[model samples]
Target: MNNLPEDCIAKILSLTTPRDVCRLSAVSRIFSSAADSDDVWNHFLPSEFPAGFAAPEGLPTRKRLFFSLVDNPLLLLHDPPHLVSF
Candidate 1:
């Protein structure tokens, strides 16, 4: 797997679950870098995210953004009569 190109490795990792990716990172430095690649992590983010909406301030990379969303989901908006969820 280390012999493969980084893009190829990222593509393969992108198909895997987040838990699988974390385990794969333990295999080797190459896999660790591949697992942390934005190309791979971007697959875990919601498609609607950062599109019609903006991620809250301070979340840096795609990985951070993914975990942040999982840890604390965003509330789109709230009004007296209605509530919006994201």
Candidate 2:
């Protein structure tokens, strides 16, 4: 019997890069469905950026954008499922 359950699997997946998960999804329907869930995307957000991010006006058409901030050297990464303005 497997020591890790579905929830554990999900948690492990949550920590992985989205690109890695997307590639894994293409291997089978089950992975595809789970990887596509909102939960996975939500889990990815905070870890990917600093707290209290506000998207700028006139956003680009690209699916992802790398932003440079004056205070932070690390580029800000944005994806779909647009973050609600605070």
Q: What's the lDDT for all of these models?
A: 0.75, 0.50
Where model 1 places Cα greater than 4 Å from the true spot, the runs are 51-57, 76-86
lDDT, residue 22, model 2? 68
lDDT of 1: 0.75
- lDDT (Cα, tens digit) per residue for candidate 2, span 13-74: 67888677668667555566566654555565546654444436542311122222222234
Model 1 TM-score?
0.76
Clashing pairs in 2: none
Give per-residue lDDT, candidate 2, residue 51.
40
The candidate 2 region of ten consecutive residues with least summed lDDT is 61-70
Error of 1 at 52 (Å): 9.8
Q: Per-residue lDDT for 76 in model 1?
A: 42
TM-score of each: 0.76, 0.44
